[model samples]
Target: MLREAPAGLPRQAELAATPFFPQERYQCGPAALAMTLGAAGIDVAPEALVPQVYVPEREGSLPPEMLAAGRRNGAFSMTVPPRLDALLAEVAAGNPVLVLQNLSLPWVPLWHYSVVIGYDLDRTELVLRSGTTARTTMALSTFEHTWARSQSWGMVTLAPGRLPRTAQEAPTVAAAVAFEQANGAAAARRVYAAALERWPQDLALLLGLGNSAYAAGNVAAAVDAFRRAVAAHPDSAPALNDLAFALNAMGRRREARAAAQKALSLGGPWQEAVRDTLRSIDAAPRRR
Candidate 1:
């Protein structure tokens, strides 16, 4: 496998410094999440996350619970594409991936969660912080077999300003929105800003960045972001409408009216919103 790895992927990579928390009983979810969050610079313990992710009734945690816990702790957490190559790419980029595996047969299931901290392509083995073991190495084929039973589910938790190496725009934006809902606009603003650097021409990311800034009370920055979105996608009605709204908030009534009019002229589903913005601009007295 090392001999046939994709270009730019290292033959072997290991994030040995990734933290570990041995699970107690059916607490692999919390333990694995703790390790991933810790590696992303969050000082959290498995016990602290037990309440957030652990389901005592089921004796295990759910995937949504695990992701929400990550977001609550200020990380841009998201599920990665279900592919071994995608997981390896994240690990090679120094992001530990939390993976779910059915360690038993399909009908007889033993669901488990572990953090993949390293891989040796030459040896065709993966290193993980598994149950009661800080460093457990499994053959790639065995790991894949177990992982396949779980539908290859995997997720990555990243600190603000960081992104998965193989991140897609839509998932990244969804993660930012989820982070905003869990944390706050300020933290999500940073997430959106960082994503914009990776995908400048992305309309959703630009709008997200601008909307987050506005929610955080930085109208000027919001206007700048929305202006950039409109510049990149001139035909985007939502961008022009948002830009108009932000400009009006900044007391730039004339420019706001112009943008709103343009948005109304290119109206689609956003026609009503543009009309409202123009009405507000007209209702407000001109600045002296």
Candidate 2:
């Protein structure tokens, strides 16, 4: 049996050791990368692709069984700083790594995972296989620092001990999109919270939280979160649309209309959603 790795949240030092890539966004973290790699027959389990620590208010060690399970299943939860260099070396050796961050106004902090696919030796760059990109090839070391300090940077590494033969079973991109679209506010809130815990500056997650809050009837919270997201990434279409919805929910019709217009100007698949929201707000009956 494989000796299990440690269980629980990763330390900062452990995070620094993972390798990086230049083509990927620092926001996705590691788990997303792992899923892609797993689908491609690379090392490690999809869940193990990133370090997701469910560290509650209490500080306690992880169970031995859980640790064993992680190791057996090719997953690892680690720390940062001291482990940084070593982790990078492993990743440089063809192993993949994932990182997560947490920060910003939150109903809860959420986790975002991405995979490190390759690196540049001459440029000290990290390559990443990311969900946000159709192209690969990215810098390594630069992403390391960005990921480390951006909200919260949690890291994990996968060894290339095995290869795949046949097809792999993994979540499809379309399926993931559908899941997010169909997921209820409560579920979206949980996912957003988990991701935000790792990346507070993540505009997408923040906007999603705001939308989810609005959907769940927490108008105030939705507005607050959306405002923060817009502050971080002003050009974000999702943030614009979600903010418009939040404003409308709060009875700020003028501001909501302006926000919807801004979203329309941004122009994305979200344009229709923004337009629909604007029309609904305009048609809503005034409460006595």
* Top lDDT hit: 1
Note each model's CA RMSD in angstroms.
Answer: 1.7, 18.4
- Model 2's TM-score against the true structure: 0.39
- Tens-place lDDT digits, model 1, residues 169-273: 888888887888898776788888889889899998899899989998999999999999999999999999999999999999989989999999995898988
Off by over 4 Å in 1: 1-3
Q: How many backbone clashes does candidate 2 have?
A: 55
Q: Relative to the unseen true structure, what is the C-alpha lDDT of residue 122 in candidate 1, on a scale of 0 to 100?
A: 85
lDDT of 2 by residue, 30-139 (tens): 33544433433445443353344223342211222222322333332222222444445545444455444332224453334455545445455556555565335544
